[model samples]
Target: MVSTALQPVTLSEFMQLHNIEESPAWELLNGQVLQKPMPTFYHSLLQKYLVRAIDNANSVYEAFPELRCILSQNSVVPDITIIHHSRIPLGNQPIQGAPDWIIEILSIDQSVTKLISKIQACLAEGTQLGWLIDIQEEVIMVFVPNQPLLLARADMALTVLDEIALQLTPNQVFGWLKR
Candidate 1:
């Protein structure tokens, strides 16, 4: 979440300067470049398990880790980006639009506010669901368009896209790290 001091750059210019394959991905939000926080052990585990869970739940949608997506003026690399199989763009280019579901796992010392803003941006651009997983708190904050924020914990089932058949809880997600 460290912002660079360089002058603001457009999405095209930002993409030209930074490659998606770069480690410790960079994001363009509000025309400013920001580096994503390195993933912690728990963060990495959750991302792995969540993507697996999502992909296994249904074939209609697929989940990807750290996939860069271009949403309107901003470009972000969500921890996990889920999109319908039919909507997946061809070729080696970054995703051209917001994903169907955007998941962001909170890293140590990462700004929750900035993460929420990023999620909201995706939602504004037609993303159906957004999840902010707070490992320290053992809770997930769920965001959906025109819906009140939902806090899910313990055995509380999280909401997913209507077409997906996955059923998940915070405990199930965190439990992956225990193994």
Candidate 2:
């Protein structure tokens, strides 16, 4: 959705005004404020379960939900961000660069095009993996650098983070809905 309240501001300016932990409803794209729809219970559940699942993999990565990642000029709040241990910040500051893996959970009011654009931006900026999870469609769109986008269904296993030897099928992920 178009935001009328947004004034063009750099990432530093945006950060200066908003605190990531407190401003969960906003994101910065290309240095503009964008409002996000409040997440549904299903979205929350999926994010929680996926974070736990990824953490259980015990790789050198750790998952953080609703984390604000600061790119050069843009900032994004991915539903779940898995960052390599080396890149983890020493303090409580927001992530300084693109995450190793980024996952976006679709919401009814969100625009797919905007979401894809965010993913593509991250991929172009050196993100190793990105996933657009559409629980409504029971499908996921995978994005990787210099590779064809992969469309996956529930039963098919999709590579989550190849660098960490992690692969998860949509069914395995969506199955957590039974909780």
Q: TM-score for model 2?
A: 0.91
Q: What are the TM-scores, per candidate, against the unseen true structure? A: 0.95, 0.91
The global C-alpha lDDT for each of the candidates, from Candidate 1 onward, is 0.90, 0.83
Model 1 bad stretches (over 4 Å): none
Q: Which digits, one per residue and each the tens of the lDDT, describe model 2 over residues 136-179?
A: 88898988889999988968888777656667888877888776
Model 1 vs. true fold: TM: 0.95
The TM-score leader among the candidates is: 1
Model 1 lDDT, residue 110, Cα:
91
Residue pairs that clash (backbone atoms under 3 angstroms), model 2: none
Candidate 1 lDDT over residue span 6-94, tens digit each? 79888878878845456889999878888898898888889989998999996699999999899889999999999989878788777
